[model samples]
Target chain A: MTPIVKPLIKTEALTKTYGSIIAVDNLDLEITEGEIFGFLGPNGAGKTTTCRILTTLTKPSSGHAFVSGFNVVEEPVKAKSGIGVVPQYLNVDGELSAYENLKLHGMLHGMEWGKMKMHIEKMLEFVQLSDRASSLVKTFSEGMKKRLMVARALLHEPKVLFLDEPTVGLDPQTRRNIWGIIRRINQERATIFLTTHYIEEAEVLCHRVGIIDYGRLIALDIPEQLLKRTGRFVVEMLDDDRSKARFFKNREDAGRFVASLDRDAIIRKSNLEDVFIKLTGRKVID
Target chain B: MVGTYAIFWREMVILRRRLIRVMASYAISPLLFLIAFGWGMGRSLQVEGMDYLTFMIPGLIALSSMSQTFSIAMDINISRFYWMTFEEFQTAPISSSSIVLGEVLSGMVRGMLASFIIFILAAAFGIRLNVNWALLLSVIFNTFMFASAAVITSMIVKSHADQASFNGFFIVPMSFLCGTFFPLSRFPEWAYLIAQVFPLTHASSCIRAAALGMDIPLISFLVMIIYSILFFLGAITCVKKASL
Candidate 1:
């Protein structure tokens, strides 16, 4: 008989409300260990709310959330200690050195002095910030500050790591660097749950993507599978500033559709953005 | 708790980097107050069987501690709004109570440091009041109460402008009217009764009594202890309920 494997992170009918509005509605999720799972959504699509609940920053109105086998609301410290989070915003203290910030985080995680010191050094080196560890964070550039935040989050070596919009507002080079860092961390057998509105980011980084819309999960599958299910090809025809697109399962069919168009048109491989637009009839960014 | 210690340790590291400036700012107001009041109201103007300067020094000590500790709100606001560092504390493995306790302890440290500076300034002016354990206790209670108030205010206010308005309406009035610069007896019966409702009034009264070698008012101590406990609980609630 096949053995039953428990998920590293699990939520059962998780619901959150603010007065008359529901921010997260009856959400259920199961993320297995060692996979880079992405929560894909537009702005205000409840991705951050779910992340906040799992990280113990916000309480779910009703439901159960377990991280590393501990219930988040019932055992917050236990659950929180097992997870690390890099928030969308740069939350690291500008007044503190990178070393001091990590030290403080280690202390909050209840690490001993000797162990924490060693971990801090390792993390600084891992993020390629060893040389600037003693410098104040405000003096650092955006990319450097992001690297420091990554270092700070990983200092405790949490079992599950959450990255919320980790590369938003970054230059292309910095974004790629962070993607590489994410890949490296996941390769080390840590389960990573990341949220992003960037469809390309979700397509490239996530092993599996869970698309959320209006506080509900609309799709969950491997990125390739989602793309295949939507269509393998998309034909585009541009009129003024607005472009209309149609999906086809194969390149031949897509090319035939583009030929039938009367205006300027092109055919391109389908991406997650095409899949999202197909699923919801709305652009991922819109 | 280890979490509390960690939080306080971070505060100390940040404070240490700005130690010189912080200490200088602490001394400036009291120096100005002494120059303006001490020479403005000479020794011939006695208050409660003491020279005006003697009575005013203890008040300055109380005022210094209260103002210094309550200013923790600004630091917390900057962390929440601009630096966003306080979110780290929220996401940390620490309990909400532990976070509040850590910040309150940091406030107490700042308040004690400011009071120490005022004591030095008083000594330099050749004015010495009775110093005892009770004085330290009073200052600790004062900071505990005001620092907890700071946490609540910082968490609830949505913007820096709201914080400024809070300081304008609440802190500024309390600083001058709550027996920090003058005894409550100077006010009318109705105004004195109103001032008595403020925690700062009790704090300044306790500190002044301790410095004057007068009997410690157990009633005022009880009032202050209750205020501290209530405010501490409120601070924890404010932190736990906070979301962005």
Candidate 2:
């Protein structure tokens, strides 16, 4: 019999509050090893707050959180050593070169010079920034800076990586490049916890997706299962400046729904975004 | 320890890149003050037994060190707001204590460098005074006090404008009223009592006395040390609060 493996990351009744407002309501989560878990939330939905708690940057107000078997509040240093965080914003040093930035990160992790040198070179190559390693980060394009942030986060060979909106502002081509990099990194069996508002990114990359709204998890499942739970097809009706989606069990049913509408309507396969809209009565990005 | 060095190293690298700008900013104002006040108005005036330039040298050192130490808060604010580099340390394995220690040490180093620059400018104007261990100790304590104060202020302020306003309200007044320009003996009794409340007042008095080959007052050194400890504690508390 195959043994049941424990999750690499777990949270039980975890909550964070600011004065009178709750930023993250009682959240319970379990992310297994080597799984890419996507956290989908709109702006002000507390995804970043959850990441911060798990990464040990902020403490949870109640309950418990564990990263790589170490409690975040009780054993923060141990948990931090096992996890790498790529924040939503660009946090790399603008005055320092990419190489120097990564070096500082490595040093903070207590890596020796000899190992850090080789690791930095390998990471720069992995991110395809080998040639621009010596350039100041302020001079790099947005894409290059994002790639460099990835390199710095991966420098210490962390077992778990938390990427918060890693490709929030990038051209389509650059976004695809980052997607490829993320895929390659996930292939090495690292547990990835990613938060993004981009529907396509969640559908394409996550093995499992969690939909959060108003500081609560609304849905959790594999992308295909989530879409299937809503329906197999979607019928979208376009009005003057508004759109509405209706899910059907099959293509014929969707076509029938479209035919019944006296306005412009498009029938297509249901996606993760459709499931999110069906659950929340609002667009994920909006 | 490794984490502290990492933070310090980053500051040193940035300082190296902007070395010229830093030196100019530290040197220009003090040079102007020395020329206008020391060379112009006090060329013939004697304070105690020495020329005005000689008396002003130690005061200038104390003032420059205080200003330079406080300037570290601007750098901290820039990193916290614009660069977001402080978040890097926040998510790392470093402790909050390490972060405070690293920043305070870097500020002290910058403050000492500014004092050296002022010393060089003094020499350029052909003003020399006695330099000894007492003067060095006094400057170190002064830098520690202000650097720690800067850290506390940086964590409390919200924006760059807030930081600038803090300097405008607190640092500028301390620079002028802390016996850096004129003797505290010239002030009325109430004003003298107010001046004595500032850490810089003791720092300037201790440094000036040592530079003139007089015995350093035990009270001034003791008060500066107490202020350093208080500010250091305040800085650590604020840093931990900000991390949350």
* Residue range A156-220, candidate 1, lDDT tens digits: 88889999999999999999999999999999888999999998899899999999988888899
Q: Which stretches of candidate 2 lie over 4 Å from their true place?
A: A1-4, A238-242, A255-265
Q: Please, what is the whole-model Cα lDDT of each candidate in the order they appear? A: 0.90, 0.90
Each model's backbone clash number: 0, 0
Please compute DockQ, using alpha carbons, for every candidate against the native two-chain complex: 0.62, 0.68
Q: How would you encode candidate 2's per-residue C-alpha lDDT over A65-164 as one tens digit per residue?
A: 9998999888877788888889988888888999999999999999999999999999999999999989999999888999999999999999999999
User: What does the interface RMSD come to for each candidate?
Assistant: 2.2, 1.4
List, in the given order, the native-contact fraction of each candidate.
0.75, 0.81
DockQ (0 to 1) for model 2: 0.68
Candidate of highest DockQ: 2
- Tell me which residue pairs clash in candidate 1: none
Error of 1 at B43 (Å): 1.7
